[model samples]
Target chain A: MTIQPAFQCERLCIDLPGAPGVRRIIEDLDLEVGRGQFVSILGGSGTGKTTLLRALAGLTSHSSGRAVYEGREVRSPVPGMAMVFQDYAHALLMWRTVRRNVALGVEGRLRNGELDQKVQNAIRMVGLERFRDEYPWRLSGGMQQRVQIARALAMEPSALLMDEPFGALDAMTKASLQDQLLAVQAETGATVLFVTHDIEEAIYLSNTIILLKGSPAHIARRITVDLPRPRDQIVTKELPEYLRLRHQLFEAFRHEIHA
Target chain B: MMTAVNAPAPAVAGGKERPWIFHAADNVWSALQGLLPLIALLLLWQMLGDSRSPYFPPPSTWAAALIDRTNSGDLIPAVLVTLQSVAAALILATSLGVGIGGLIGASPALARCLGPTLEFLRTLPPPTIVPVAALIIGVNETMKLFVIVFAALWPVLLNTTLGVRSLHPTLLEAARSLQLGVVARMTKIFLPALLPSILTGVRVAAPLAIIVSLLAEMLTLMPGLGALLLMAQRNFNAAEVFGLLTVVGSFGFILNAALAAFESWALMPQGRT
Candidate 1:
């Protein structure tokens, strides 16, 4: 079945101020994301994977090109778009309780009872109903990232942007969060553009993987995941298809490292 | 690395039957260690004043005078006056310092441009300005508050600027991605992020507040603890001077403790623990 483009980026470029002069971060990038699809952007450090996601969220100002979302030009982050950052400890405000953090995603922008209901539902969805009153610092790394995901989900955004959301967790925690994130994305059916440096993670979670280059990041490659949904952490990792995809992505990363 | 030393000292309770006696010994040992410097100072005073100098009084004589002052209430009023000056200075300095600090901190370009000039102003000996302040504002409460605010504000201001600038990048990105407006971002993210640093700066500035308040009063001959100390000096009341000095030191200690308690309590609600 054909799907409409949830977002389209045309020749997007980013120039950042530097010590000597302005540095070009990204130049002339084009991409498209379909509704309910999970897209991953993979890049080495200094490549503009995160920057590209930020541009999509309207948090970064591009020197050129356009990010069209649902036939509208993206200029600022609105209800239709939401972002989850790396370093979950800082992503959620230390001062806000878990419930309040989720509430913050929807409150004042939505009707009163509806906002409350959404917050509750998101909390339950994240399996953090028991910790609704606890602060972000009290949560484990994986749990805190879950709260961040829940906050994004609570907004009911059309497209979700996640930048290495589980990057700070231990390996075990990272695997667990990967499953939980895929589950959430499946349940919500929100289009996702997630960025990461881990090649295996990119393949395991993404429906479409976009590779980025450094020193004025440009699209290096694109790979599609044809794996079945409702994926399991243990079974999925052991599968032959998963192993093949992992080897392919790792080879690509190895090339970048060699370069 | 520290485990070798920290490993259950026999003196710790619940370790052994002898722990009660050892715990008492430990308390006494630490208390004696804290008092070692005071004991040394007293010994030096006694040695110096062994019928040779009028400038230095023995610790026993200072203690006697301090006890007498407690009975007489004269020292009490003088101490109270000094404390009041410190309080007033602290209030004025905090409000003005934090206000100006927040303004400068919010504007990084302005802070960078004016920081050196502010540093120069802060480095000037605060006492030197007392006479100028006296001439302009006269030797009044206003002069004392002015000097206190002027002299003590730098640490707070600089700290605040540093605090605001020290915001975690993830928090900032979160705020922006959440679609918070500029004013909402400032109130929610900037203020909260800067609070710890602001408290640290205020802690650093507390002693400055006391020093400037007393310095201003002494230079301008205002009726505060500094003037009281000066009066004691002129009368050659060595014991009274020592007594007043002790009071001033204690007051500074108490004020700092209070501020520390407040800092801990305020930050506690934010899950700082």
Candidate 2:
């Protein structure tokens, strides 16, 4: 039996209001994300990668074509999908404690004790049990981002859309968060559509990487990683397969820049 | 990395700390320090003033007059009447301001259309509005309320509108993605996010409400502290006039302090630090 795709979009186009008239941001794009798969869209700055992620999340309206989620049209945000934003400071409610921020997504749906349990479990999953009662503003940037992720996790979403969730963090924090995200994805089996400008990060975390290029950007290439699962940061990066993929991605990015 | 390497030394050796009682005493001492200037000024005035002078009665004479009024049951009633009017106006103003401001703030087109007219009306002085209100409502409780509400409403309305407009777009996105209904979105999201600004607006409006109510009472010869002050001044009762002035000033200060306390308490969850 063939498994159905979690999200599918065909000939998707988006036009934003600009200086003179409308400017096309995404043009004639086609993509599909499979169930329980980690897919990353890699592109340089101004390639509309974030816009495509927003479109998939139903936050932005496409100018034409259709975006379907499990055969249902996605015109607005659906309950079964959660988005993790890059700017955790603005995305996470500063007034709420770590556990309370995590509870934001599940508060209306869950009851008293059940809500508390889910919030605590989510916080523990992100290794923030000690900081659960503290405010988000008091924590470091990486911890704050974990709070946001824990919030998404508490929603019990079927799909997670992340827009460069760790782009602001330092190297050590970024590596640690990347590993944590992989572990969470493995445990939950949630389909992830991640947008990132980092090529190595895309290769490191994603099962499939979609390269976007050009003025009104469209998918230039799709590369699948057949590397073994339960990958390590030190061990995985040193692999011959990982090195080959990195070289290929570098060449592809350089080609797009030159073109 | 350098700081990280050196940070552990302090972490390992950190033991020196002050006792909780010392901290509490320090706070009390600092608060008392803030009142020293006012205490010194009052003492100097007491020493320099003449008890017999009609123009410059001593501080003791003002205290005696205050005690006399309190005993005769005039001052308390006058203060209660003024407080009641101000309180009523504030409730009305807050309700109208938040409602109208939220509506205008949510829509850019509405904000643009009403912006100029609201700006002009907001700049009109409270004394000017008091007479007009008296002319229309005839110097009653309703007229005093109208004047106070009109003067106090603008700060709240403008601040709330600006606050709502400046809310981070990501919050709205999160609310939408969570599939929150209108009521849930308002109470859980919008109101909590806009609370700090709303409290700031209330802080500004509270003082204005008291001042406007007092001004209205004095202008219309209404039975409040303002009228008492005017009557005392006209009768050349310097002690009573000064006492009433002190009372009014103290009342304004107390109201401001109460609102500030409320703001801090309500916003405590947000973590001021």
Candidate 3:
């Protein structure tokens, strides 16, 4: 029998307390994410992209319908799933060293030696082994973001929910981190639901890009990226298919904005 | 390897290491500069004052009186008693403040409910309650401790509450997502984040702890430096009074310096450069 999808959101709706009564954020949204698949949710500003991600992570409750994780209703954060937030500085414990921060998720669950190895592997995956003893606050923004990712990775979750994790970094750092994230996913085979507004970044990193449109948003299009694996930043962008997909997304975004 | 280390490296002397004695000398020089005016006034008073003056006794007279106290059996024990009360009160205040502060800070409804009564209690001067406390609790070590804790707890509680309120929302989310249990949340997350602020509160409260304990001792006449100082004044022993004042001032100075050193070390970021 085929395994169930990692997450399924069925007719999910969410509302937020606004200045003018309660405002609807997500309406009648349905989505299914397969295990080990890389998907990026792309949207414009104020389109409830984050609200959807939060609902899936079980951080924010839905007004109606359901968000299902591994065939169970998700009303709160569940085991075997971890979230990497955008604000690395705030997300990380500032007082903890890189090694300790990475260990935060899985520290008490495993034995001391097992926990140490998991933390070490995660640090090595993010290339933060050299600065293991240094506190998170002392690291640069890119390094700090890596510390957060490593923290999530150490949990060894079946699925990773990331919300604009690399949005705060400069171009060089963002590109490098994207490649590192792809490699990490390949190794762990964890399903990823990444949320971002950057068109090029979504196309580069995801196997499928879900373009979100309109207020109280639902997915407007889900485009599968059939590009070759072991993707190179320079070579992949130069590919005609990659260029076509990039153009297609830009056009979609432009058309949606005008509408 | 394109490992770009963007963080600023910590400052080091770069060449041969300077001897620690030189650093010590620099600190001593600065401290001496700070004390110069007081030293000058004391020296002038010692040179100009009459030996048998009823008032305005010189530093020499104060020193003689201090030596006399040392020879007597009462001085050391009184100081020890005062120190004990201050230490106990401070310990109690810190624990109670952090415990209650964390709860109130985490819950908006709790803070709102307790805010009025706490504000009212906070406003009533601690010393003003001492007599009232003595009447109710009776003048003993327990009453003394209660008075000092009441006086010292406000700073720590206020600081810890402020610390908790300012905590990053994402940190709690991170903790929750990690499936960290309640005990782990407090020990690992809350305590570490609130530490610097707690230390700040304790620093402010330390002086209050010492002062209030002394006040309680004086009011009760329960055998401490406070009582000794009052007794000396009542007997018109000007020299003894001056000596005791100097002793208290020295204790305050040393306590403050020790706390500052501890706070600096505790807050020092590890593995810089």
lDDT of 1 by residue, B1-273 (tens): 011243355443432223233334444466558768987887887776643235666667777877887787667776777788777777767777777788787787888888889889888888888889889988888888888878777777888877766677778778878877777777767777777877887788789888987787677667777887887888888777877787788788678767766775667546653
Find the candidate with the highest lDDT and give its number. Answer: 3
Question: Worst ten-residue run, lDDT, model 3 chain B?
Answer: B1-10
| RMSD of each candidate relative to the true structure | 5.7, 4.6, 4.2
- Candidates sorted on lDDT, descending: 3, 2, 1
**Every model: iRMSD:** 1.6, 1.2, 2.3
Top DockQ: which candidate number?
A: 2
Which pairs of residues collide in candidate 1?
none
Question: Tens-digit lDDT track for model 3 on A1-259?
Answer: 6856998988999999999999999889889888999999999988988889998998999999989999999999999999999999889987788999999989889999999999999999999998898778768999999999999999999999999999999999999999999999999999999999999999999999998888778889999998899899999999999999999999988865596
TM-score of each: 0.83, 0.93, 0.93
Q: Model 2, range B1-273, lDDT digits (tens) per residue?
A: 011232223333233222233334444466568878987998898999788998989889999999998999999999999999988998899888998899999999999899899889899998998777778888799888988999889888988999998999988887887777899889888998989988889889999998888888888889999998988889899999988999998888778666766676677667651
Error of 3 at A203 (Å): 0.1
Which residue pairs show backbone clashes in model 3? Answer: none
Pick the winner on lDDT between candidates 1 and 2. Answer: 2
Q: In candidate 2, which residue pairs get closer than 3 Å at backbone N, Cα or C atoms, i.e. clash?
A: none
Clashes of 2: 0
